[model samples]
Target: MIVSLHSYIAFLALAVVLLAFINALNGFLTGREFQQKRDRSISLAGVAFFHLQFLIGVIVYFVSAKGFYALSEVGIGNLSSEARLLALEHPTTNLIAVALVTIGWSRHKKASSDKAKFKSVALFYGIGLVLILSRIPWSQWV
Candidate 1:
């Protein structure tokens, strides 16, 4: 049940983060005045969802057979590509991605200029999205 929830949250996290990244990028590129309500809300949603997903993922890591168990049983050097991904890369990368998104949100809040806020969201969230994408277990999820 938790695993399923984790998977479902992954979709939400990805969608919102992607949306936030695109919106920020567009705003930055166009030099548009940031609509504080809309922009802040969107970015907040992305960070919230991703952070929730990451928390669930951490729980799953400790409990799932494919996560910590595989890492322990097979060992890092012995793991197949798929096992390595599930046990190590996916969690590690997503943890970093979550941190990046959170940092972006913090930076955006601190930025005085609209362009700087947009740029902060665009660059950090965009990189977070890429990292999340690079590590996703496509076969398992999709």
Candidate 2:
């Protein structure tokens, strides 16, 4: 159940993160004044979904046999490439990505100018998105 939730929520979280990144990039490219409502709404949506994903992942880590148990049973060296990805790389990288997203949101809140705000969102969220994508268990996920 937790795995299913994590699998599904991963889609929603990734989609929102990508959308937020694109929206920020658009704002930057267009030189648009950052409207609090639009910017905050997008950022908040991404953050909320990401938090949900993280919570599901935490549960999955403990509950899914393929998670921590596998790590303990086989040790890192014994895991197959795919198993290593699902058990370790995906979760760790995603956690870091979420942290980056949070920092981006917080920094955007404190930014003095529209350009600064957009840059904050664009740079941080962009990196976060890349990190998330890099670690996703693509073969299993799809």
Candidate 3:
């Protein structure tokens, strides 16, 4: 059940991250004034989604048979590629990715100008998204 919730949350988290990244990229490229309230809200929403997803994923990792149990059964040194991806890479990489998103949102607030704010989101969130996409176990999830 927790795994299922984590899986479902992945879709929403990815969507909001993409939306926030693209929106910031557009604003940065076009030199648009970042609407203080709206822009921050969008970034915050994305950050919130990522934070929630990461926590749920951590919970699922401990509970799911495919997660910690598989890791324990095979041991880290003996894990197969699929098991390694699920038990190690996915969780580790996703955690870092979410951290990046959170940092980006926090840093954007400290930025002095609209361009800086947009750039902060574009760079951090964009890289974070790529990391997330790379680490997801597509074969299992799909």
Candidate 4:
């Protein structure tokens, strides 16, 4: 059940993050003023949703047999590629991605100008989205 919830929320998380990244990139390229309602709120939503997904993912990692248990059961060296991805790569990559998103949020708040804010969000959230995309269990997700 938790794994299913995590999977479902992954869509929301990815959508929001991607939207935030695109919005920021657009704002930066067009030199638009970053509005609290349009820019800040979307970025906040992206960070908040990703954090929620990360929390659920942590729970899934602990409770799901395919997660931590796989590592313990077969040992890291014996894990099949799929098992290694679930047990290690997926969790680790997402954790880093979340950190990047969080850092982006923080940096945006500290940015002196609207362009700087947009640039910070664009760069960090974009990288985070890429990292998250790269490690997703695509075979299972589709």
Query: How many residue pairs clash in each candidate at the backbone level?
Result: 0, 0, 0, 0
lDDT of 3 at 45: 85
Least accurate 10 contiguous residues by lDDT in model 2: 1-10
Model 3 over residues 1-142: C-alpha lDDT tens digits?
Answer: 8888998999999999999999999999999999978888888889999999999988888899878999989899999898899999999999889889888998998999999999999999999999999999998788
**Model 2 Cα lDDT, one tens digit per residue, 1-142:** 7788889888899999899999999998999999878887997898889888988898898898879988999999999988898889988998898899899989998999998899898999999999989988787779
RMSD of 2: 1.0
In terms of lDDT, model 1 sits at 0.94
lDDT of 3: 0.92
Comparing 3 with 4 on TM-score, the higher-scoring candidate is 4
Q: Rank all candidate structures by their lDDT, best first, as comma-separated numbers.
A: 4, 1, 3, 2
Task: Give candidate 4's whole-model lDDT.
Answer: 0.96
CA error at residue 84 for candidate 1, angstroms: 0.2
lDDT, candidate 4, 1-142, per-residue tens:
9989999999999999999999999999999999999899999999999999999999999999999999999999999999999999999999999999999999999999999999999999999999999999999997
Tens-digit lDDT track of model 1 for 1-142: 9999998988888999999999999999999999979999999999999989999999999889999999999789999999999999999999899899999999999999999999999999999999999999999888
Off by over 4 Å in 3: none
- Per-candidate TM-scores read 0.97, 0.95, 0.97, 0.99
The CA lDDT of each predicted structure is: 0.94, 0.89, 0.92, 0.96
